[model samples]
Target: MGSGSFSSVLKKPETTSFIILVLVMVGFTLANDRFLSPLNISNLLAFMPELGIIALGMTLLLTAGEFDLSVGAVFALTPVSTLLMVQNGGLSLELALVIAFAATFLVGALNGFLVTKVGISSFLVTLSMLLIVRGTTLVLTQGFPLNSWDGDNWLRTALAGSFYIGTVRIYASLIWFAALGLLALYVLNVAKVGNWITAIGSNRSAAVARGVPADKVKIWLFIATSMLAGLAGVISSLRIASASPVAGSQYELEVIAMVVVGGTALTGGRGTIIGTIIGVLMLRIIRNGIVLVGVPGLAFNIFVGVIILAMLVLHARFNKSSERK
Candidate 1:
């Protein structure tokens, strides 16, 4: 490749992450031939989209200098509420969906209001929201798993159904994830709103002074973040044909880790949808690989720590090089 081409490739934020993903895949495959087996690959793809959808929303929040810790709980809350309404309240599925998502939207709006209007820290506000939402879900469902779908519905199928191609499975959730990811990429890189978000994260007061509706944009992003989480939750419940009140209980931290490891700054002002995708895949692959290779699942986070550290170094080097040029 020409020097210019090489430089351009290196400058792309996801390059190192993609390289690491390939390395991890190869390493795991070498360790256990099953890593690349059709069963394992199908399983990985089936489960990945749940987290992938959440990570896309997180990328936007991080890029805008904000985050919603309540997403994990929202993931559970939305679907559980929808299913309950359908089963117990005798509501139509479509109406149940609208009501459930609207409730989730209200949660997001309240979170934004507390942070941006009430002068509370986003972290504390969202953390509190997490607990509140989780508690509400538990109380509503009495800690039981919601009933599964017995009849076929196009919406449910579109959200979570799967079909096999020979021995390989293709899931509708994966399709949803990819479609949303492409949309997110456009929003973050090609849209004017994206620039406004970046500006707010880079310097909030300055962005406000420059005529960006910083607070309003943040509120909308918060809503978007929660809606994405809810969608993921709904998809997840449909995939298993049941919604657990405790589903996605730990997803908040995992999504944050994926975003950070994918090259998004924890403190915000920068992020990449493609990098988040790589991060999500890398983490899931490592998690799957560990279990297959006889490593205890408890040690999974150890690998995550090491990978995060390595990514930090890699990103720093690339950034330094870019600055020099």
Candidate 2:
């Protein structure tokens, strides 16, 4: 494709998301004047980073034609691992954090290895890993919340504290999210490895025939996804000052929804960091708006289901139109 065509195709996905974001902002603002207030807006933005980080990684994996259903479990375990290290394993906070992240990365690598090397379906492999990790956390913690590290001031400040911009709180994790988003964007758009990733996701068999190391690419993507989830978990744990085995129980769904809504194809080989960010923000705002409008918390799940269904329909129609053209 020529550069002009390529740029146009790239811009199309973001345009849809940008429009959705604008509509969401307008709808929420009309519903509640407080929605546009600096405090509420800042709070909304604050929740974006952790999910944004996970979604960024998940976007890459999904673009490569794989799914990581184990992310939420991995997320839950990271903080559990950190708590274990600090309390039961007698490690310092810093060392515990390192081990926590490393362990999550290793888990991700294991998922990748199983899917690529053992020739298992990515869905099945990560699904099994999800149960395994969750079960292990339960057995280790005996179904109780891990609460021994509440006094780590330095760790708390570094991982969970916010910087203020004239009274608006910008979280440390938000900074990490921005940095990682830029890095992921660069790797996807400007690097040779990004091409390989797109090739592998677009057509694994063709990628292999072209001498691309498909397995290696997949393994690394899995690890990267896991590391992002782990980091998010660690930050969340610090912010909450405790680790609960069930903390991230449904987070995988949220992240997947964010990616899909952001226009990342479930079939892979198509997505963008900017779209994922917009998708994440849109979902967050919808959830927040539900609360602001006094919708029952339980009813939000129904709303989410409806939103996902609508997006899927739109995606199918969009793809069909593109193919016809």
* Predicted structure 2: lDDT: 0.85
lDDT per residue as tens, model 2, 144-229? 99875667567688768888787677888888888999999998878998888888888889999999999999999999999988
- Which RMSD values do the candidates have, in order? 1.9, 2.4
What lDDT would each prediction earn against the true structure?
0.90, 0.85
Among all windows of 10 consecutive residues in model 1, the one with the lowest summed lDDT is 316-325
Residue-pair clashes per prediction, in order, are: 0, 1
Candidate 2 Cα RMSD after full superposition onto the native fold (Å): 2.4
Off by over 4 Å in 2: 1-11, 153-155
Using lDDT, give the best candidate's number: 1
Q: How accurate is candidate 1 locally (lDDT)?
A: 0.90
